[model samples]
Target: MFPPGFFDRADPSPDHFFYAPPRLVTHIDDQAIAAVGVLYQELGMTGEVLDLMSSWISHFTDPPERLVALGMNQVELAANPQAHEWLIHDLNHTPRLPFDDNSFDAVTCCVSVDYLTQPIEVFTDVARVLRPGGLFVVTFSNRCFPTKAIRGWLYSDDASHLEIVKRYFEAADGWAEPVTKQCIPPGIPGDPLYAVYATAL
Candidate 1:
């Protein structure tokens, strides 16, 4: 068995919940969406980017030359206007990625980091696929499928969740200094979302 806190085992069978669902909705609200744009602005535009764990939409404001998406559902990825190419795969089943070393200029995982059961290995692979000085970005909100979210995530606070993603960057050996951003839209009437980012070491 995996370590106690490494993953939430109560929802061990996410495929059962994931396979049949098709939520054609954006997880974050308008304010949060704008906040993502602001975050992406800081990331800078004009390079190849990989949208890891992407869905029906990618909140990237500035268009890049190439945007690739790797997701669980092809329909969702196809619906994403920003993705030029998409691959369907479950990272929980295979933490390894199929891309060559230093393939992407940047990587973005949006709103789906809480579902990972094998984050460390995935983070390591992300580091391997990114070019030197390239970036890895992870964004998440307070919304998730309750039955599918892991037990650890279900009980954790917003601060702890940010720390969890930060730790993923830290545990990945080749990541440069990682920065965590709190996406607290001022005077917003909803759950708080956060973004954590890092550059390749």
Candidate 2:
């Protein structure tokens, strides 16, 4: 378990107030963006990818051949030029994903893991939907809406955040050992960019 009271303090209102109107902006700074780009390049640029909790702008500098986005807001998903296909669904409402087993070659959740109340189960489901040797990558920075982010995420330190996400992979059962990275670019302000990624067993 992620510890009781971890996600107990979030507002109960529909996430629409927080996400209904599209902000249409990148959450990470320019330096951080470059770091993410480097990480993506390292991940390689082939096969179908599922962008979980996707938004109007994916961090990648170029488009992939096949990109599928899933998220809560339809308008935001619709506006994203990177998405080859987009599906509207709230993962918080239904953590059991609708995708077929072993479907995606790679999966990404960018800056949105803080909002998940059931991260372990969702991570387990991620492994189920990923093909053998498929990668599940989660990236985040310090920027977040404190009121909307889950309770556990609101107070956790950066090192603890890494451990927390690592635990998600561990609890998922079928995921191989995760590789943790701090995507820091020189002279960037605020917290360093971080990603915890692993291959499916």
Candidate 3:
């Protein structure tokens, strides 16, 4: 388990307040976005996909059959052309997902895991939603809103960040050995992208 106050954010303000404006902006640069798309292609994310804590741009160059976006702002999600459906929810306040068990073939949280306050519970729920052999992919870049990012993420480097996400998978059941990948090649001028993924056992 993480140490006390590990999940505390610098800004204690409600997440809805910060996200209410519906900023339809891409968090990472084009290079990082392309890297994310390549990572998704490697994962073979073709079936139903749930984009948790997603924004307007999911970074999925090859869109899935059915895409659902869940996040804090409705306008941003609405702007997502790839998403067939959208839901507004605050994971920090309610980690429980609003979906049936084994509902999706894949679950992805893009550039937003650091904002989660209850990661273990959320990860378990992610596992529950995935079918057998289904995967959960989490991708992140160097950039983020510092005030909303948790203390654990704010203080950690790129390697430690991967370890933290791996531990989240370990803490939950029904997950295979997590595979970590460097989406962008080394010494990139754009944001450094990384991913940690695991399949349902």
Candidate 4:
């Protein structure tokens, strides 16, 4: 079980209040973004892909067939060139996805996993959407809006953050052993990158 106040944020304000205005900025630096792209390519994330908590750029060099980018901001999703279709959705408000079961080959959340108030529930929905053998990749950086990040995320270090995400996958069904790895490009002096991913069973 999770600790008390695990999901609470410093700013207990509504998520919609903070996300009302669209931010078209990139969260991680170029090298970090490239590292993420390399990881995606290495994992062979193809076919119908779902980008959860996505932004303007997916960092995907070769786009998938049906790339669905879902996020809170409409403008951010609208600006995404790789997304065949983008939807405005709030995971905190509703952890369940609108898609039918086993709809995607891969699902990725880039540098935005810390904000989830209901991570386990969201991960369960991720399992529901992913086809068997599909990947659920959740990547994050050392940076975040401290006020918006959950208490567990804000209080934990990078290693602990990976464990937290790993636990989320373990708490849900239809997932194989989660893989935790560093995505920071070697010799790149910038934001640290990390990922915890698993394959749907």
User: Compared with the true structure, what per-residue lDDT tens digits does model 4 show for residues 1-201?
Assistant: 898999999898878899989999999888889888988999999999999999899999788888999998999899999999999899998999999999999999998899999988999989999999999999889989889999998889888998999999999877999999988833568988899999999
- Best candidate (score: lDDT): 4
Clashes of each: 0, 1, 0, 0
A best-first ranking of the candidates according to their lDDT comes to 4, 3, 2, 1
How much is 30 displaced in model 4, in angstroms? 0.3
User: What is the TM-score of candidate 1?
Assistant: 0.92
lDDT tens digits by residue: candidate 3, 66-171: 9999999988998999999999999888888999998999999989999988999999899889999998999998788999999999999898999999999999
Candidates 3 and 4 compared by lDDT, better number: 4
Candidates in order, TM-scores: namely: 0.92, 0.93, 0.97, 0.97
Evaluated at residue 107, the lDDT of candidate 2 is 91
Model 1 Cα shift for residue 3 (angstroms): 5.8
Model 1 lDDT per residue over 33-152, tens place: 777777887779459999888888888788679999888876787888888999888888898999999999999888888888888899999999999999888988889877667777
RMSD of each: 2.2, 1.7, 1.0, 1.3
Model 3 alpha-carbon drift over 4 Å, by segment:
none
Question: Between candidates 2 and 3, which one is better according to lDDT?
Answer: 3
- TM-score of predicted structure 3: 0.97
Residue 194 of model 3, lDDT score = 91
